[model samples]
Target: MRYLPLTDSDRGDMLATIGVSDIDDLFVDVPAEARLSGPIEGLPTHASEMAVEKHMRRLSKKNLAAADAAFFCGAGAYRHHVPATVDHIIQRGEFLTAYTPYQPEIAQGTLQMLFEFQSQVAKLYGCAVANASMYDGSTACWEAVAMAGRVTKKKRVVLSGALHPHYAEVVKTMAKFTEDEIAGGLPSMQGSPDDAGLIERIDENTSCVVVQYPDILGRISDLTEIADAAHKKGALLIVVNTEPVALGAIKAPGEMGADIVVGEGQSIGVGLQFGGPYLGLFAVRDPKHVRQMPGRLCGETVDAEGKRGFVLTLSTREQHIRREKATSNICTNSGLCALAFSVHMTLLGEKGLRTLAAENHRLACLAADKLDAIPGVRVLNDAFFNEFTVVLERDARELVRDLAEDDILAGVSLGRLFPHEEALSGGLLVAVTETASEEDIDALCSAISENMA
Candidate 1:
C-alpha cells in the first residue's frame, strides 16, 4: 500500500486551523489554466528499484558517448581525459557525502578544499578572489551581471553577439525580472564581436559589458580596449569563458583588465556527463565588491592555537542568514564537481596544464588546416585556441548528421542555435581537445572531404 503520512481528516483540520475551508483553498494562488488536469502521459506511478535500474540501464545504453565515437563536439561542454585518480578520490566517503559545513570547527577538511578551489580559480583567472562554485557557466554569467549591477549601481548591460547563445539567453532571462536593459550586438561565427558597435551601445546607465574569451566561435579577444571603454563610461567589463583550458595558452581575462571573469571549469576535471553537474568558476577584482558577489567563499584564518585554519568567510550574501536581503538566493554550490576540479588541477599543476593546452591548440590547428584543404570548405579564423569555425557548402546540421551516422561525433552547427542567421546556417564550430589525436583529426578530415566530393 502507498504511504499517506497525512489523512484527509488531518489535512482538513490543518486547513481549517489556517482559516481555509478546504485543501483546494491552499492552491488559490495557482491559476486553474496552468494546473495539470491529470497524470503526465507515459509516466508510471511507481516502480521497484531493481526494475527501474534495469530500465534506466537499457535506456542509457543507447547514447553515443564520447568513448564510443571519434568525438569532436564541443560548444561549451568538452570531452577530455579525466584521470581515474580524480574519480577515486572524489568518491571517498568523507568527500562524497559531505554537505555544506555549517559548523566551521568540525568541517575543516571541506572548508580547506573549498578555500583551495577558490585560490586556484583566482590565480587562474588572475583575479583578486573566487567564490566556491555556482550552478554552472550560464548561471554564473547571470550572477556576474547582477554583481556588476550591484557594484556599479547601474541598470544597463551590453552583451557581445559572439557570446554563447545559451549564455546570452540565461542573462536575458534574468534581466527580464530585474528590468535591466540588454543590448546584443551582431552575431559572428568568428567569435569576435564588432566591439566598436557594442561600444556605441554603452552609456552612463550601463553597469557592465559582457564578452566571452575565445568566444563562442573560438576566437580569442584582447578586452583591454573594451575594458578601457567601459571604465570611461563608469561601467565594468565582465568576461565569460566556456573553455577554461584556453586560459593556459591565452592571456587571462584579468590581465586584459576585465573587472570580472567567469567560466566553466569542466575541461579541467569534470566530464561532459551529457550536460552537467559541471563547475562554474567565478572571480573578481579585489575591492568592496566582494560583499556583492554571489555564492560561498572560504577564507584563510587563525584558530585558537594561532595555527592557520580555513572557514566559510564572507557568507552574508547567501540564503541562510541574509534572507530576502541576501545578495543572491543561490544556496548550495557544486561541491562534488568543485572538489573534482580542485583534485584534477592539483594533479596537473601549472606546467602540465600549459602543456596540455598547447597540445590542444596544436591538434585543433592541424584539424583546421586539413579541413580547409578540402574543396568547398573554408576556415574562418586565423586566431584560435582549441576550437574554430568552418564555412561549409551545405547545411551544417545535415553535414553533422551525416558525419554522426559514420560513428564520428562531429562539431556543433551554428545554424542549430541561431536559426534566423542565414549566413551561419552553413557554418560548423569544430573543437579539438587533448583527447583528440592525429588519427582522429585525419578521420574527420577524410569524412568531410569524401562527403563534399
Candidate 2:
C-alpha cells in the first residue's frame, strides 16, 4: 500500500504555495555531493509481506541467538530472568499504551509510577533525588559531567580508566560538541579498579571525576578516597554503575559521597533485546542542583481535598520550557522501560534484592574458581560481584570466535575493545548471572579448556 498521503494535485498545490517547482527544490540548501542522484541501490523497491519475512528469516539464520548458545555475554547488557508478573504489569493497556505524562490530571498513574521510579533509583544510588530517566547509561554519564561543569564552572572532567569504553566514548562525543574537556582513555584491560593515577590527575580545573562502582570488570573498590580527593580540589565525584544489580550487595555510591550517580538499570525487569530500550538511572546528592538534573522528575503532593497526587515536578529539557535555560537537550523519558524497572524493584524489596544479589555473587564465585582452575587461565578480580576478567594463555578474541563455532558463546574479550593494548589481548571478560546455571558454567569451562588445549 502507498504510505505517502499527498496525491499529485496536493503535492503540486503545496509546492506552488511554497514557490518550489518540485520536491528537489527542498534540497537546494543541501550539498550536491550529499544528495543521492537516484534511488538507492541493493534494496528491493517493493516486496510482499511474506517475501520480506522470508528475506529477514534468511538473514537472521546467519547470526547466533544468545539464548540458543551457552551464552555469557555481558559487557553492559546482562541476561536476567525477568519475572512473568513484571511483564504482565507492563503489558496492561494503561501502562503499555501510555506515553510521557504531559497531562498530569489524566496521567496521574504514569506520574505516580515515575515518582516511585525516581524514589527507587534515588534509594538504590543512595542519592537524594533522581530524574524520571535518560536515554541510557552512557547519555546519563555525559549529563552528569555536564551538570558538574555547571556546578563547578569548569570545563575539564577527569574520567577513571575503569569506566566502560562505550561510556567513555559517549562522554568524549558530548564534550566534542561543547567546550567541556575529557581526560583519560581506555581503562585497564585487566579490569583493575585501582584508579590512583586518575586521582592524581585532578586539580582546580577539574569539574568532576567519573568512576565506576564494580567498574566494567565487576571489581568493587572504596570510593571514599577518590571522593575526598575530588572534594579537596572542589571537584565533584561522579559514579557510573553499568550493572545496577551489584548495588544490592555493594555500598551505594551516595553512601561513599558521590556528587552524582548514573548507571544502566537494564538488569531488572528488562531483557537484552539484542541491545536496548534500556533504562538510564540518574541521581544527585544535593537538592539545590535538582533543577540542573536532566530529563523529567515526578513529585508527590496532596491536592485540595488533601488526597495524595503526583505531578511532573521538574522538567529541564529545552522542549519543556525556555530553550536557552534548559538543562538538557534530551526531553523525553523511557516511560515503559522505567515502569518495568520500578515494578520489578517494587516486587523485590530491600530483603529480596539483597538475597538476589547474594545468589549472583555465589554463582560468580563458583564460575571464577572453576575457570581459574584451568591450567592456563587466571581470574583477574579478587573482589567482585557477578562478573570478572580472566587472563588466558591464548588470544581471547581468537578463543571466543573458536568457541562460538562449537555452539558455545563465551565471554567478551577486553582486548577486542582495546586492540592497541597487548596486555589485554589475552584478557577475556566472563559474566555470571542468575540465568547461568551450573551446567551452563561447566559447558563454558569445558569449551574453553578444549579450545585452548
Candidate 3:
C-alpha cells in the first residue's frame, strides 16, 4: 500500500469514472499473449532488494554475452567501436540530468546538441533537413509511412521485400488503426540484390515505396531506378536504414532522390543494450515536408547581441491544435541517445568514418569469403556494406543453436523471422564489422564448417 499509495476504493472509483468494469479494460488494445499472466516468472511478489539484484544478475549471465562470444549478431543492430569520450560527455550532470528543452533560454545546451545531431544525421542521409530524433529505426519507419500518407494524401504503401521485417511489422502495427494498405513483406532471399519487381508494383494508390538501403540481408543497390520509378508515379521514396555508418562508404539516399530517410543510429555512440533505447534518425529531402516530420527539430539563430544561439523549431501540427490531426504522436526525441550518436559522429569526422566504413567492408568481405569456402554455405549478396546473408545446406536455426553450444553466436536465422517461408528455411544472416578480427571470422568459419559436416 505504501508503494502503490492507492487504495482499492481509489482504483475502483477511477475505473468506474472511465466506465470500465476493471483495470483489465485498460489493456484491451494489447494482445492477450503480450499481457502479464498473474505475475512475472521467478520474481516473487516480495523480495529483498539485495535478493532481487542478485537474481537479475544471474539471469543476465544466462544470455550469450555479446562481449565474450564470437558475436556476429546483426539483422538491424550492429557492433561498433564507441569511444570512451562519447560516454563521458553524455554523462556530464548538466546533460544526463536534463530533460527535454521546454524553454529555449535555459535549455540552450540541449537544443544546440540536438541541432548538431539533426545536422549530422541530415548529412549522413544526404537530406535537406532532419528531425531531432524518433523512437528507433523501426518506429521511424512507421512515422515515415504515416508522414508520406499525409504528404501525398494517398492510402497505400508499397514495401520492398528487402526492408527489415521487424521495421515492416512496426509499420503494420500502426497500419491496424488506419485504412492504409501495406503491400509486400516476402523477403528477397538469395537472389539479385535488386528487388525482382518491387518498383513495378507502385501505382496511383501508392503514397510511398519503403525500401531498405543495403537491405536487411546486407545487399547493396544503387536505388536510382527505384527512386525514379516512385517519382514517376507521384509517390515519394522512403528509405529505411538500420545502420547509419554505411553512409560513409555508400551513396547517400538523399543523393539517390529518396524523399524521406529514417533508420537506427545505434551503431554510432550507442551500444546494443540487448535491443532498445537505440536512437532513431529521420531526415527529408523536401523542405516542404518538414512540418509533417515527426519529433522535434532544432534551428540556429542570433540573439539580441547578435551572438549565436539555438532554438527548438518545426514541431508537428499535431503538437498544436487538432489533437486527432497530430503529425506525430511521438512526444519527444530520444535526447540522450541522440546526443551520444552526435558525439560519436563528431569524433569520427568525415575521414574517420570513411576509414571505418572501408574497414567494415573489408572485414565483411573476408567473412563472406570464408563462409563461402564452407562446402554447404553460399554468400548471397553480390555487394554489401558490413552484414550479409548466406544460404546454408542445413537449417539456420539448428546451425545457430549448435554453434552456440560451441561458444559461437554463428548468425541470425531467416526462418525465425519468416517462419512460414519454406524458401528461407536454411538462410543465415551474418554480420561483420570493424570490431570483428581475423580470429573471429576464422573461428566462425571453422565452427560452421564443422557443424555442417
Candidate 4:
C-alpha cells in the first residue's frame, strides 16, 4: 500500500497557509500539455512479484554492458579502470553507511577522509580550497556560475562554444529563473576552438566565462587568453574539466588564471555506472573566494589536548547555521562517491595517475591514427588528450546504431547531442582509456570501415 504522510486536514491547512486553493492550483505554472490527465498507456498496473522480476531480467539483457563491448562513449562520463582496492575500501561498514559528518567529534574518521579529499582536489586543481563534493559535474557547474554572480554582482554568463552541450543546458536551465543573459551558441566544427570568438562575447556585465578543458569535441585550448579577457571585463573565469585524468597530463585550470575550477571526478576513482553516482570537484584559485564556494569545506585543527583533529571548517548550505545567508541550497553531497574517488586517487598517487593518463593518451592517439586511415573518415582535432572528434561520410547516428547491432558500441554521435542541428549530423566523438585494448581499437576501426564501405 502507498504511504500517505499527510492527512486531508493537514494538507488543507498547508494549502490555506500558502494561499493555494488546491493541489491542482499549485501546479498552475506547469504547462497543461505537460500534465498527465490519466494513467500512462502501457501494460497492466499490477503484476505478480515473480512475473515482474522475470520481466526486468528480460529487459536488462538488452543493454550492452560497457565491459562486454569496445566502449568509447565519453563526452562527460568516462570508462576507467578502478582498482579493486577502491571498491574494497569504500564498502567497509564504517565508510559504506557514512553520510554528512555533522558531529565531527564522533565522526572523526569521515571528517579526516573528507579533509584529505579536499586537500587532494585542491592540489590537483592547483586551487587554494575545495569543498567536500557536490551532486555531479553539471550541478557543480551551475553552482560555480551562481557563486560567480554573487561575487561579481553581474548576471551575464558567457559560455564557450565547445563546452559540453549537457553542461551548457544545465547552466541555461538554472539561468531561466535567475534571468542571467547566456551568451553562446553551438560549437563550430574546426581544427581549433574559437577562443577569440568567446572572448569577444564577454563584456562589463559578465559574471563568469565558462569553458571546458579538452572540450566536448575533445579539442584542448590554452585558457590563459580567455581568462585574461574575462578578468579585464571584471568577470571570473570558471574552468570546467569533464575529464580529470587530463589534468594529470595537462596544466591545471587554476594555474591558467581560472578564478574557479570545477570538474567531474569520475575519471579518477568513480565508475560511469551507466550515468551517476559521479563526484563533482569544486575549488577556488584564490583563498578569498572560499567563503563564497558551495558545499562544505573540511579543515584540520588542534584540539584542547593539543591532539590533531579535523572539523567542518565552513558549511554555507541552507541546512547549516548560515540559514538564508548560505552560499547554496545544496542540502547533502555525494559522500559515498567522494569516498570512492578519494580512495582511487590515493591508490594512484601522483606518478601512477600520470602513467595512467599517458596510457590513455597513447591508446587514443593509436585509435585516432587507425580511424583516420579509413577513407571518408577524418580526425577533427589537431591536439587532444584522450578523446577527439571525427567526421564520417554518413550520418554518425545511423553509423553508431548500425555498429551497436553487431555488439560494438562505436562512440557518441554529435547528431545525438545536437539532434536539431543538421550540420553536426556527421560528427562523432570518440573517447579512449586504459581499458581500451589495441585489439578493441582494431575491431572498432574495422567495423566502421566495413559499415562505411
TM-score to true structure, per model: 0.89, 0.88, 0.88, 0.88
Off by over 4 Å in 3: 1-55, 320-322
| Number of the top lDDT candidate | 4
Q: Once superposed on the true structure, which residue ranges of model 4 sit more than 4 Å away at CA?
A: 1-59, 316-318
Top candidate by TM-score:
1
What does the lDDT come to for candidate 2? Answer: 0.87
Compose the digit string of candidate 4's lDDT tens values, residues 208-243: 999999888999988999999999999999999999
Write model 2 residue lDDT over 133-248, tens digit each, in one string: 88889899999999999889999999987788889988999899897888876566444576788789999999999998888776888999999999999999999998888989
CA-only RMSD, every prediction: 5.4, 4.4, 6.8, 7.1
Per-residue lDDT of model 1, residues 72-148, tens digit only: 88889988898999999999989898778888788888999999999899999989999999989999999999999
Q: Tell how far residue 56 is off in model 3, in angstroms.
A: 3.6
Worst 10-residue lDDT window for candidate 3 reads 313-322
**Superior candidate under lDDT, 2 versus 4:** 4
In model 4, the worst 10-residue window by lDDT is 313-322
lDDT score at residue 376, model 4, on the 0-100 scale: 90
